[model samples]
Target: MANTKSAKKAVRQIARRTAINRQRRSKMRTFIRKVEEAISTGDQSAAKSALAAAEPILMRAAQKGIVHKNNASRKVSRLSSRVAALGKQA
Candidate 1:
């Protein structure tokens, strides 16, 4: 479909970027899932540690444009609260 040389190169670049972005998105989700799993188990220490690890990954994804800034902040806020509540329960 790309008749021009420049267009073909652009397509290749897009494909490469798409692969990289997909990897980043998958990794970010994995980190989030870890936090959720820890929360679900109601392990305060584990949940707190998982949240600490996930927070930076989420923020990095937002910084790299994988997710929105507010979206990352909202997730961090909610997870932090849940982790805190686990503490209160004990």
Candidate 2:
């Protein structure tokens, strides 16, 4: 239990921050899923476009501390490579 006033304020702040971070994470996942769906359907253009839309969101999430920067960059790299491969296939 937070006994002191300061401690109670910190707990409230943490709760608010947690909700915000959770929402951000969920949004990031949604964008990533869009890219994956496009890739799975073998639609190179759609996949590329989805990746374009998702890239900023992913990077922003990293910048906002929702995810580590390398983790976000790695995801972008892998997704972009898959999208590129899709182009080669067609």
Candidate 3:
């Protein structure tokens, strides 16, 4: 549908960015889920470890523009607080 060469190039670039962004979103979700799972199982150590693994990935997602920084920070904050609370609750 892109008759102009420039339009075709733009389409190609969009596709590439979309694919990359999708992968980043999926990975971020997976990491967050892992942290949540660790917390749910009531293992403070595992929850802490999972948080350690996920925090940087979330931050990197923000830095790469895949997600907003405040959104990322909020998620990280909530997750960290939840994980921290596991220690007290246990």
TM-score of each: 0.96, 0.98, 0.97
Tens digit per residue, CA lDDT, model 3, 1-90: 999999999999999999999999999999999999998899999999999999999999999998999999999999999988987876
Worst 10 residues of 2 by lDDT: 81-90
Per-residue lDDT over 1-90 for candidate 2, one digit per residue giving the tens place of the 0 to 100 score: 999999999999999999999999999999999999999999998999999999999999999999999999999999999999998988
In candidate 3, stretches whose alpha carbon ends up further than 4 angstroms from where it belongs are none
> What is the alpha-carbon lDDT of model 3 when measured against the actual structure?
0.95
Q: What TM-score does model 3 achieve against the real structure?
A: 0.97
Worst 10 residues of 1 by lDDT: 19-28
Q: 68-90 in candidate 1: lDDT tens per residue?
A: 99999999999999999998998
lDDT of 1: 0.95
Model 1 alpha-carbon miss at residue 11, Å: 0.6
Model 2 stretches astray by more than 4 angstroms = none
